[model samples]
Target: MAPLEYLRPSDEGAAIALAEADGRACLLAGGTDVVGLLKDGVLAPSRLVDINALPIAGVEIRDGGLSIGALTRLSDVADHPAVRGRFPALAHAVLAAASPQLRNMATVGGSLLQRTRCGYFRDPVTPCNKRAPGTGCSAIDGEHRLHAILGGSDRCIAVHPSDPAVALLALDAVVRTRGSRKERAIPVDDLYLLPGSTPERETLLEHGELIVAVELPATSFAARSCYLKVRERASFEFALVSAAVALDVRGGVIRTARVALGGVAPRPWRARAAEAVLRGSRMTEATIAAAASAAVRDARPREQNAFKVELVRRVLTRVLATAGAGG
Candidate 1:
C-alpha cells in the first residue's frame, strides 16, 4: 500500500477545498472501493479526503421526484419505505448488491463512481487502458468471460459493475453535481463516457466536482417496475446478465416501456429500440420475443461472453412479463 495522508474535514466547503488544492486527492465515501484499490497499489493517491461529514447523506421526497443524497447507504435505500414502495425496482437492485455488511457501508455516490471489476484494472502487473492511457487492454483477446458487449470501444472493453445502475438508467435518473464554482445536473445516462481513446476517463464530471444527489423522475411506469439479476451464484455475486424494466399498460396495450441492461455494457445500455417496439402493442409471447430480440441486436460480445446475449434476452423477457402481469 502507498503512504497516504488522510484528512477529515468538518463540512462540505472544507472537503471541496482540499480536493481542489490537491489534484491527487481521493474521496473516501465508504472506503469500500477506494481502500481496496489503495491496498492493491492500483490507485496510489498522495492524500485521502474523508467526506463523510460533508452532509451528503439522506433520502428525500421532493416536489419533482425522489432526491437521494450521495452519501445515503445502500442498506438505507433498500430498507426505506418510500423507496421500496415508490421505486421497488431500484430497491430490488440495491437488494441484489454485495452483502448486508457491504451494503450497510456502501454509499449511493460511491456505487455510481465504482470502477470496473476487470482483473486487469486492479492488478498493477496487467495491462488495462482504463488504468493506463497508452497500455493495451488485456481483456480484448485474453480471458474475457465478463467483458462488455455494448458501448465498448477498441481501446477498452471492461463492463460497468453495478446492479443499481441498471435500475437508475431505466428510471431516467439525473445526477446533481457541485463544484468549486458552480452546480449542475447531468442525466444518469450521460454521466458515463464510452471507452473511447480516453478509456481512463470514466465519467463526465469535471475535476473537483462532487456528486450531491440523484433525482429519479416521476413516471407512471414506476407502478409496474422490476429488476432481475442473474449471476454465477445466487447471492453476493456480480451479475452475469441483469435487466431492469418498467411498463405502463393501458387497456391491454403497452402505452410506455422503460428498459435497461447491466453486466453487459461499459455504460448501462438503455433498450430504447425495444421499448419503441412494445409501445401501443398488445402483450404476447411473439411480440415480447421480438422486442427482446431487438434489445441485443447490436451486442458485440467477445469470445467468452457470447453466452450473456441469450441470458440477457431471457432475463429481459421475464422482467417484461412480470411488469406486464403487474406483479
Candidate 2:
C-alpha cells in the first residue's frame, strides 16, 4: 500500500469539500472494502477522508420509519431489536452476508457501496471496462457463471454484490446523501446505475457525495418478509442467487407483495411484475411458480450462466413461500 494523506473532517460540509478538492480522495468508513482495494492495488487514492469521526452510527425510529446511520456496522444493524423485529428480511440479509468478522467491521453504507465481486474487475491485470473505461469487458467471454442475467449491457456484465441492498429494495428503502452541491434522497433501487455505455460509473452519486443514511418505511411487509440466499458454501461466500420476498397475505389472499433479486443483476433487482402477479391472489405452488417465471422472463443469460434463470425462479418461489408462511 502507498502512503496517503489522512484527513479528519469536522462536518459533512468539510468532508464534501475535501472530497471535491481531490478527485482521487476515497472516503474511509469501516475500511472493510476500501482497505481491500488498497491492498489489491485496485484503487490508490491520493487522500483518505476518515469519516469515522462523523456522528452517523445509530438506528432509530423517526417519522414512523426506521432511520439507520450509514456508519452503523452490519452486525449491529442485523442484531438491532427494531430491525430483527420489524424487518426480519433486512436482518436476515445482513446476517447472511460474508463472515462474522467481516460483518463486524463492515458498515451499512460501505456494504451497499462495495464493488463488484467479478474476478476480472478485482484483478488489476485484467482488461475490465468497469476498472478502465473502453478497455472492454473480459467477463463477457471469460468465466461468467456468477455474472449477471439482468440489467447487463455489452460494456459490462458484473453484478452488484450487496446482500442487504436486495432486502432494502424489497422494503422500498430510501438512501440519503450529501454532496458538495446539496443533499438529496434517492430510492435504494435507483441509487445503483446499470452499466450501459459507462461501465466505470456504477452508482448515481456525484463525485463528492457520501451516503449519510438509509430509511426504511414502516410497512406490514417488513414483518412478514424473509431472505433466501443460495451460495456455493455454507458461509463466507457471495450468493449465486439470492431472493428477498415480502408478502402481505390476508384471509388466504396476498394483498401486497415486494420481491427483489441479488447476484443476478447490475443492481439490486426489483421484480415488480412478480409482485403484480401475487397481489390479490392466494398463495399456491402454481401461483408461486408463475410469479417466479414472470420475475425472470426478461433475463438475458449467457451460455455458462443460462442456469441462473431457473435457479432464480426456484429461489424466488422458495423465498415467497417462506414469506407467505410467515417463516
Best by lDDT: 2
Per-residue C-alpha lDDT of model 1 across residues 117-194, encoded as one tens digit per residue: 999999998888889878899999897899888879998988898888888988888999888898989998889888
Residue 249 lDDT (model 2)? 82
lDDT computed for candidate 1:
0.88
- How many clashes would you count in candidate 2? 0
Clashes within 3 Å, all models in order: 0, 0
Error of 2 at 79 (Å): 1.1
**RMSD of each candidate?**
1.0, 1.0
| Whole-model Cα lDDT of every candidate shown, in order | 0.88, 0.92
Cα RMSD for predicted model 1: 1.0
- The TM-score that candidate 2 achieves is 0.98
lDDT of 2 by residue, 4-114 (tens): 999999788898899899999999998988999899989889999999888988999987889999999999999899999989999999999998999889999998899
